[model samples]
Every structure is written in C-alpha cells, then in structure tokens.
Target: MSTPFSPRLIKGGLVLVDPDTAQVQRVIALQYNAESLRRELKGQESGEAGTDRAEPTRFKGVALETISFEADLDATDQLEFPDQHASAVAHGLAPQIALLESLSQPSSAQLRKVNSQASSGMLEIAPMLAPLLLLVWGAGRVIPVKLASFSVTEQAFDPALNPIHAKASFGLRVLTVDDLGFASKGGALFMSHLQNREQLAAKAQPVSLATLGVTGI
Candidate 1:
C-alpha cells in the first residue's frame, strides 16, 4: 500500500480499485480540476386546441444525470511514485498508461472459467448463464467507469526520453445504475455509493447554533 503524502496532512485523490479484489491499484493526487454535471430533460409540446399557441406538458420529463471531472497532473517536482527507481518527474506517465492498458484487458480468471464452462457444454447446463454471465461481465474491471480519457503533454524530457516536466489531464465518466443494469455488480455498487455520499454530505454539514441564535436580533 502507498503511504499517505504526509504524516500530518492526508493526501486526497482518485483511487483506482480492482473490482474483484477491492484492492487499491493506483492513487492519483488531486490538483487543479473541474467537474461537469449534466442533466437532460424531455417533454412533449401540446396546445389547447386552436389559439395558435403551444405549451409544454405540465408533467416533468425524465432527468438523466451525468457527471464528469477533469484533473491536471504535474510531475516536475512531484514524486508520483516514490518507490520506483526512476525520477518521479520522468516516470509520471507510467502509472497512467499502465491503468489504461490494464483496463483494456479482460481478467485471466474470468476468461479461464468462461472457456472451461464453454468446453464442458455449460450452455446446455444453463443456457441463460445467469450467475456466470454476471460474473464474467466487466472482468478485470479497474474502477467501474463508462469512459476514461487522458492526455499528456511532455514539456521537458530527460536524456533517456523520459518525461521530466509534463502536464496531464484525466477525465472520467462514472458508471451508474442506468449505464450498467440494476442487476449487475456495478449497478448495485453505484446505488450504494450514492446513498453513502448523500449520508456523508448530510453529516458533513451541520446547523450551527451560533448562526441560528444571531438571526435578525
């Protein structure tokens, strides 16, 4: 496990965890960032019959919520991975690339089980393959996400072509219950996550007695 940035202050950042093992694989520190939350509404136009006037239905349309964030990474003086032998600045992009690549590959265990089942005519055993299919879905998942985009611009490089100074931007679209059906693991986790966040936020903000007592005195 990676140690906290400092003994006194806790380092905060994005954590990529293994879906199966629930192990933290990487932690990228939070820097300058922006979050985008979008909602889409749909409605039908209607008219009372003749007056050449149209109005939207009183009923509200379905709201689709999406959230995304862009964060910057600088490695000039920051050690992204202290345990590594190379210069932190020079090797900053290593973990980012590794995460992308890892996400692209499916889990070996899942694949082996799937292959084994197929070889044994498992389809005949369970044509729908309910339980097994669910497990196989998103095998080797590195953080439940619909999309992850990253771009790195190397401003400076060492003699060995390793980046010494660089700027990287990373973006993510979290997978929610809507994206991954409610039956799936990701969907369940997403719902639980929302509930947890809601609770935390509620607790984080408390009604201050000092403020209430000073109202309009």
Candidate 2:
C-alpha cells in the first residue's frame, strides 16, 4: 500500500528586528494559524475635493493599511508531559501571553535608564525607540507594523487558576516609508512589500473594455 502525500503547513508569525542592522531579535509563531485575517486600506488624497478635477484621482503616497487577526493558544498537549514542559505545567499560557504583550511595552532596561536619569537630576530625556516589528504572513508578505491594539481572553484555566487556553486578538498598523523614512530598515522592508504587491498585480489577467459594454472612453 502506498502512503498518501501530506502537504506541509506554513505558520504565520511576528518578527522583531533591530532597526539599525535588521537583525532578527525574536520570533513569535502562532500556535495555530488564524482562520481569517482582516485588512483595511485608506488612500491618501493629494488635494481637497473640488480643488481640481484631476486631483480627485491623485494620491499623495502609499495607502495606509491595517491588519487584524485572532490566534488561539493552548497548553493541553504540553500538559500531558508535565516533567518535560515544567513551565507550561506551572504557568500555563502566561509566559506566551506576556511575550506578545511585551511587543508594545517599553523594555525594563529602558525604564530603568529613564528612572536613573530622573534621579540624577537630568532634564529632557530622549524618547526610547522600540525595535521594528514585522508581521510575517508568509514568504510573499513581510511588512513592518506598529501594534495598534491587543486584547487577550483567558478561556480555560488549570487547577492553580493559570490560564491554559486563551485567544489573543491584535490590530496592527502597517508602517511605510512615510512613517519610517527610506534610510531606516523598516522603510526598506515596506518598499519590498510594496514591490511584491506590484508584481502580483502585474500577473493578474486584464479584461477588455468591450466586456463592460464600452467601445471607447
């Protein structure tokens, strides 16, 4: 008997990269792929309405894009082997939840530095910059984004009241050259994403004007 072929599964993840060298710092892969992803795009109009007839079709730059999705995390499988997965048996999914939450939060090191400066009587501390965050859907799409919103609901818990199953929802605003500038690593990644979109668009089949009951404009 011949064995049936099984397809390989690709998981989506979030990647944190250094802004200067583009080195990947951390990768958080979704335990299970989100069933659906929601995306919204808003065009940047060049001028006010009725300012000029041609201005209606003009655009200032790339459209603002946002993506949202919900992922589920569960520790049931790991809980079967308590000795091997001690952390999962102890804290349930708290560590995993904390990892995602930390994306939007300033690091402890940065907070300590700020506190030190204040205690030393220093004024006008500079703002701390976070590492570039990238949403990786697949090989075709990897774009920089800012965490707009994040919410998690604990569905199931262990005996100690630690959450074992949870659902995490995230809203991400796609960062572009306008936000990051061309010199930054994030800006470069955004450009690559844009270019990939253009390539995909080029592969799309075109229809004739006659199909829409039009001979000529």
Candidate 3:
C-alpha cells in the first residue's frame, strides 16, 4: 500500500520590529492557524456628497484595509511534560496572553521615565511609541498593521484556576504609505505588499466582453 501525500503547512505570526533599525524584536507565532480571516477595504475618494461632480471617482490614496481573526491556544500538550514546560504547568496560557497584550503597550522602562520626569517637575515629555508591528500570513502577504482591538476568552482552566485553553481575537488596521509616509520602513513594506497584489492580479486570466453578451460599447 502506498502512503498518501501530505502538504506542508506554513504558520502565520506577528512580528515586532524596531522602527529605526528595522531589527526584529519579538515574534509571536499562532499556536493554531485561524479558521477564517475577515478583511474589509474602504477607498479614499476625492469627492464627497456635496463635492464637485468632476473626478468623482478619483481616489486620494490607497484604500483603508482591516483584518480580523481568532487564534486558539491550548496548554494541554505542554502540561504533560512538566519538566520541560514548567511555565505552562504553572501559569498555563497567561504568558502567551500577556505577550499578545504587550504589543499594544509601551515598554515598562518608558513608563518609568515618564513618571520620573513628572516627579522632577519637567514641563514636557516625549510621547511613547510602540514597536512597529508586522502581520505575516505567508510568503505572498506581509504588511504593517496597528492593533485596533484585542479580546481573549478563557475557555478551560486547570485545577489552580490557571487558564489552560483560550481563544484570542485580534482586530488590525492595515497601515499604508499614507499613514507611515514614504521615508519609513513600514511605508516601504506597504508598497511592496501593494506591488505584490498587482502582480498577482496581472497573472489572473481575463475574459473578453463577449463573455458578458457584448462585443463593443
């Protein structure tokens, strides 16, 4: 009997990169791939309801895009090997959950600095910025995004009330050159993502007008 063939799977992940140096700071890979991904796009039009009729269909820039998905994380398998996965045995999924939550927060050091400056009666302090975040789905799609929202539901817990199984839902707004500007690393990545989509669209076969029961306008 011959064995059936199985295709290789690629894991999707979120990566945090240093904005100035373009160095990867952290990588959080989803334990299980999302069952489905939802995406929405809204165009930036030049004309509004009361605007000029001319160039009504003109676009100011790339359309705003957003993506949402749910990822599942379980510590069942890790709990079996307590020696190696001691953290999972004790904290369950808390560490993993915290890692995701930290993406939206500034570093602890930054917070401390601000507090110190305020105590010293400093008039002004610079705003804190989070690391640049990248959503990598596959070889074909990688783009910068801002975490708009995040929610996690603890489904199962261990005897100690530690969450062992959970589902994390993420809402992300795709960042483009308009948001990041052409000089930024994220802006460059957005351009590459746009060009890749254009290339993919070009590869798609096109049908003539005859297919729609029309020869010419």
Candidate 4:
C-alpha cells in the first residue's frame, strides 16, 4: 500500500511533538515562504603577542549550543482536507490553531500548592506547563529544537467572520545537552536524534589524501 521511494520525489517536512507525551502533534507539509537557520559561536578576545590586534580565542562554551530559526505556516490550500476546503474557512484555521496551542500548552506537571492549613497546602498543582519539541529534517540535516515563540495572523474572513486564510510565524531554538535532561519520551528521542546526526556527519567526512594512492602530486 506504500509508494516506492524515489530520489526525484521529495518527502517529509517539519514535525512537532509533545515533549511530555512524545506524540506527533502536527506536521507542516507546505512550503514556507521563508525559513531561517542560525548558529552562534562563543569565545573570548585575546591580544596577540606582538600585535596591536586582538583575536577571538574561541572555545565551546556549551557541549552543544542552541540555534534559532523562524518559519511561516500558511493555510491556503483548497485541497488540504474536507474541513479545510475553500468554503470551510473556519475549518482551515483549526489545524493551525491546534498546532500553535499545542506548542503553548504541551504538558503540565504538578507542583505543591500553598495554603494556610498544612494539610490542605500539601495538595499538588494541576498544570505546570512544559515546552514543545520541533524537528526539522530539511536541508539534508536533522535538527531537534524547542518551540520558542509562535504568532498567527488570521486574514480573509468569510461571511460569518471566520478566518478562511491565515499565516503563522514561529521561532524555534535548537535543543542542546542542557535541554535534553528531562526524562520524558520526547526529551530522550531528542537527545538520541542529536547523537545520530553527529554520528552521520562524522561518517561523511573525507579521509586524508594520504589514504588515496594519487596523493603524490
């Protein structure tokens, strides 16, 4: 029942997951108008021995650093789904709202309640919010990230004033070792994905020219 894979055909897109439950909450399959990828390096400036110029004496501040990126989501496809057809303007917005809301309210943990009476104060808090996981496998790279910011703009309302077309812009910060400490299923998977990516990158490196017989030039 599955179609055969072909290099000519492109497959897969951005995936979002609930960090607490490790469930695939949403998948963004449309082509975004724009997407940004950022990387940062940390270091200290040090003066050279006999020069007036100072150079950056860089070092890895964190074992793994976080990167941030922004992307836009649009609901303009008439063939998206039955509920997302052209006439179903409100329905077109449901999935986008669900995606954004899931990021904002991924999971909750219990906290100690404060009360005057000791016995009553010992109750646990109901909902302690947690973050969401963003996975991007585009550009021949696999990256696990955390949802940083999300904003949506609904436009093209129908006669009922329901949003028929909308665009959502969101930012994601790549997860690092610091963010993978949580013992949730998503957290564990995030860590494993990072490790696997690193391994694959290492394997793709070209060996030294000495390893080849034509290196005498």
Candidate 2 local distance difference test against the native: 0.95
Local accuracy of candidate 2 as per-residue lDDT tens digits, 50-101: 6754466778899999999999999999999999999999899999999999
- What order do candidates take by TM-score, descending? 2, 3, 4, 1
The TM-score of candidate 4 is 0.54
Q: Count the backbone clashes (under 3 Å) in each candidate.
A: 0, 0, 0, 0
Clashing pairs in 4: none
Top TM-score hit: 2
lDDT per residue (tens digit) for residues 42-160 in model 4: 44345666776775554323344455444454445654565646544555466656655566553332223222334566465445555455555555444566666767677676466
Task: List the candidate 4 regions with Cα displacement exceeding 4 Å.
Answer: 1-76, 79-87, 106-120, 123-132, 139-142, 182-217
Taking all chains together, each candidate's TM-score versus the true structure is 0.45, 0.93, 0.92, 0.54
Candidate 3, superposed: residue stretches over 4 Å from native:
1-6, 48-54
lDDT of 1 by residue, 64-127 (tens): 3333444444555465455653545455555554554344345667678778889988665332
- Give one digit per residue, the lDDT tens place, for model 3 in 1-217: 4346756778998999999988999988899999999999988777656866545568878999999999999999999999999999989999999999988788799999899999999998889878999999998889999999999999999999999999999999999999899999999999999999999999999999999999998
Q: How many backbone clashes does candidate 1 have?
A: 0
lDDT of 3 at 88: 99
Clashing pairs in 1: none
